[model samples]
Target chain A: MKFLSNLINGISLGSVYAIIALGYTMVYGIARMLNFAHGDVIMVGAYICFFAIYSFNLNPVIGILMAVVVCTVLGVVIEKLAYKPLRQATSLAVLITAIGVSYFLQNMAQLLWSANPKVFPTIINGSIKLFGGELSISRTTIVIVLVCALIVVGLSIFVNHTKMGKAMRACSEDKEAAQLMGINVNKTISMTFAIGSALAAIAGVLMCCAYPNLQPTTGSMPGIKAFTAAVFGGIGSIPGAFIGGILLGVLEILGSAYISTELKDAIVFLALIIVLLVKPTGILGKKIHEKV
Target chain B: MAAMLEVNDINVYYGSIHAIKGVSFEVNEGEIISLIGANGAGKTTTLHTISGLLKSTTGSMSFMGTDLMKTPADKIVSLGLAHVPEGRRIFQGMDVEENLDMGAFTQPKSSIKGNKEIVFEHFPRLKERRHQIAGTLSGGEQQMLAMGRAMMSNPKLLMLDEPSMGLAPILVDEIFEIIKALNKAGTTILLVEQNAQMALSIASRGYVLETGRVVLEDEAKNLLNNDSIRKAYLGG
Candidate 1:
């Protein structure tokens, strides 16, 4: 019974990671550039949502929408101003630039919002119980799961069926050929970043609601966990990221309950290492054959 | 017919190495023009320069009397110039239909459906495997997809580089047949090929490039029968 309860908790936590993981997967799929500042962007989103609720006294729904919009614009701006100028530079340089941006955003948040953890008002205060084991699920957790599922479905449809999605797919496969086909590579890349960041922002809001605690550095652990999920499923595959996130969440919860809480992150990392060692391409990733 | 594309003394460099030194040529409208050369003979470089993938260091390229040297690669497609790069750079992860749709990215959304119908009409095989991932396809199928993708843009001039690099003899014949059929349908083509015999046989006019220079240019039939071209490139 206790195991079942922990399992539910794990899934709820994993759902949050899955939402954040989608952003990492989407951006990495198209641009092949690891935006190190992605985690910080999550923090930025949380802070924006916080201010909207506390400072502006806006409704939770409006606050969430505003957070998504602001984060998306910030993402676009980051790509245009920071990444675009260094398009021709080495990958290492771009990676370093990403790190610089990450630190810059983190410090900026600290300066603006302070380092103290601010209490987030509960958007979903109710909880439902199930089974003899007393399975309790929060409204915030339900909303988070539903929103993540919606995003995943929406993204899959966009990539599989729509015109812009097809263009993005083409760009991910062969950027130069897509350009020859007259797809604006820059615009597509920018749009990818914007969408990915917006998703991250939503994940941040749901996380704040569930935990009800906000800090300048709250995004770091979740971002790393999402990245782990992205790698576990297949960095380039959207579906893979979804599965990976949930799996990670479950594993962490189970480990904390049965094993020790101190070993939770360590155990997860160990599993990741073992999985990677066995299958370098990941569980769902396809191996790319380079032509001579 | 007026020259659809004029390459006037274009010099292309890779870092400091002069890959194409003042190479000049003219592609007339509605004609199949073949640029035949050995490895590293600036055939691909010339195509890249004209397609605006690589800017010329010291020359001018005009397309339909418009200065095309300064135009970006993506914009060149809308200007009625479609480039099929070497190695058939198809979007491997996408399906056949998706790859074809990408070719029509510059056009209005309304025309895309119509263009897709035309592409399917030309290559019925692509229509069959419209939902199949391009990377999973055979080399010949991939080649067909590449050509089909280029045609989807409805360009006035189509540039193809080394379309027969790796394929079975039958697939090679099929590709050449498609090229001739495309030409007969009134689409001007710039063909860069190492298979000189087949290229010269189908081309209206041919140019032999050697070490970044146009060593010879003549009617395809004339070049086919020429002693030097026959001995060196045609394997006579």
Candidate 2:
């Protein structure tokens, strides 16, 4: 019963990481750049949600909506202002720009929100008893899991069935050919950033609700962990990110509960290193073979 | 009659290297115009420039009276112009059906089904492998997919670059036959080829390019029979 309860908590936390990893996987898949600033975007979203609900006395849903809107705009603006000009530049150059953007957002958030941590309000209260009250699952955990499932399903359908989604896949394969086919490459990439940032907003809110500690740097460690989840599942594969996140969360939780709390992160990363050594493409990544 | 496509004195540069120097040509409606040259003679560069992939420093290119120079590369396809770039750049990751869907990206959603059917009719081999991953396809089949993909947009002016580049002789003949059939169906063709004999045989008119200059221009039959052309390009 204790093991099952731990698994549920791990899954709930993993769901948040999965949501965040989706943003990292998608932006990397289409734009071919790692937006390190993705974590900072999460912080901005959380701050927005906090201000909307606590300061303005808005509803929780309205706060989430505002966070999504602000993050989406912020993601697109970041791509346009920082990344677009470096399109013809090298991968190293682009990577450096992304790191620079990450630092900029971190500093900007500190300036606006200050360094003090704010307590995140509990959006969903109460818990459900299971196994004759021996096991308990928080309402927030269930909501997070449900939301994650919905997002995964919705994204899969959109990518497989929609026109814009087809365009996105085409651009990922060959930008020049996609252009010849009349798919606007720039617009598709911008849309990717928009969707990714929107997901980041929801992730930020859920993450804070779980930990209840909000600060400018709240997004950084989670963002990096989610990035690890993306790599664990396979960098460009959506399903990979989901699977990777859940497994990472389980490992981290179980490791901390059974072993040493101080060494849980190290244990999680060590497991990743072992998995990568055996199968370098993450568990789900396809080996790229270019035909001559 | 007005030309279907016209390019006047286009000068294209690859940084410091002048790739296409003051090149000029025009394609009239319902005609197969072949540009034959050895490698690095700017045939591919010329096609890329006209399709808005590369910028030209000095040139006036128009298709059906629209200024192509100002048009963006993605918008050029909606203007009824399509280019089958060299190497048959089919999306290797996508299936055959998805590739066709991408081909008709600019067309109305209602037309995708009909366009796909037409493409299948032209190359029934593709219909057999509709679900197959494109990267695993044989070279000849990949070429067919490339041409069939270009046809999905129902282009008024279709530009083919090195369609027969790495195919067997029999497959080359088969591809040329398809080109002729496509032209017969009223799609104006601009073919660039190193296979001068095959290209000229199917084309109504031909231009012989050397070092970025059109050194010879005449009816296809005339160029095929010209002594210098037979020696230099036709390998007589």
Candidate 3:
């Protein structure tokens, strides 16, 4: 019964990471740059939602939508202001700029909202009991898992079937060639960031609802963990992110429940090291071939 | 023949080094015009500039009456112009059909079906391997895919850069034949080639580019027989 309960909790947590990791992976795949500030964007999304619902007394659904909208716009603005100019710059320079952006966002959040932690409201409350109350599952877990499934399926269809989605894939492979094909490379890249940040916003709200703790630093740890999940599953593969996140969550929860709570994160990182040493490409990362 | 594309004194630079110095040429409607040059003779650069991939320091470029210099590279295709770049830069990560779909990026979805049919008619091999990843295809098939992908836009003028590059001799003959057939079907061709003989053979007119300058311009037959052109380019 405990094992089943832990598994459900792990899935609920994993779905949040998967959502956040999707943003990281997509941005990395198309922009060819690590957006280190992604986690901070989640914090921003949470704050937006917190204010919209708690302060403004808006409905939870409206708060979530507003968060998604704001995050999407913020993403486009960040790309234009910070990353676009560094398009031709070296990877190291871009990495440093991303780190800078991350710090900037964190500091901005601290200044705007103050450093105090707020209790995030229970947006969805209730639990489902199975097997005569031996195993219980939270409604939030069901919602997060369903939302994650929908996002994964919807994103797959969009990338495979839509015109703009194909353009994004084409741009990732060869931007110059995509330009010749009459694809607006810059616009496609901006769209990628937009989509990624919107996902980040949802991840933020879901994470806060599950844990019910809102603070400037709430997004950073989960953001890094989701990034690890992305790398674990094969950074650029959509299915990989989902798998990686779920596995990471399961591992973390099982480690804490069975072994030591303080050592769960360490166990997760150690497992990542071992997996990378074995496969190097994560579970689904394609072996890139250099064309002569 | 009415001029479909006109360039008046365009100079292109890579940083401080001038690659194309005051180069100018034009392609008439429904004619195969060849730009024959050795390596680094600005053939690809000229094509890049006209397609808006590379900006010219000074010049006027008009394609179907639109000022090409002021237009974006991606917008050039909708104005009925297409370029098959040097080295067949087809989207290698995508499948054959996905690559074709990308080729029709600027076209309407309703027209995509018709455009794809036109492409398949030209290269039936692409249709057979439509689901296969592009990078896995043979060199000749990749070249065919590149040209067929360009044709997906249904452009009035098609610029081909080194369509014969790094292909088997038999494949080269096959590609050239297709170029002639495409031209016969009323698509204006601007062919750039290092293989001077094959380029001039099918072209109605030829421009012999030497060190970023159009050294000689004449009818294809005259350029094929010119003593200097034969010596420098045709390996006489």
Candidate lDDT scores, in order, read 0.88, 0.92, 0.92
Best by DockQ: 2
Predicted structure 3, TM vs. truth: 0.97
Can you write out model 1's per-residue Cα lDDT over B1-236, one digit (the tens) per residue?
55899998999999999999889999999899999989999999899888777889887889997889888888899998998889999988778987888888888888888988888887888889999988888888888888889988888899989888899999899899998888888889999999999888999999999999999999999999999998999888
Local lDDT at B41 for model 3:
96
For A159-257, candidate 3 gives per-residue lDDT tens digits of 888989999999888888899899999999999999999999999999999998888888889999999999999998889999999999999999999
> Lowest-lDDT window of 10 residues in candidate 1 chain A?
A132-141
Error of 1 at A183 (Å): 0.6
Q: Candidate 3: which docking quality band? A: medium
Which portions of model 1 miss their true places by more than 4 Å? A290-292
Candidate 2 has which clashing residue pairs, if any? Answer: none
Residue ranges of candidate 2 with Cα displaced over 4 Å:
none
Candidate rank order under TM-score: 2, 3, 1
Rank order by DockQ, top first?
A: 2, 1, 3
What value does the lDDT take at residue A1 in candidate 2? 89
Docking class of 2: medium
> Residues B138-214, candidate 3, lDDT per residue (tens digit)?
98999999999999898999999999999999999999999999999999999999999999999999998888898
Candidate 2 structure lDDT = 0.92
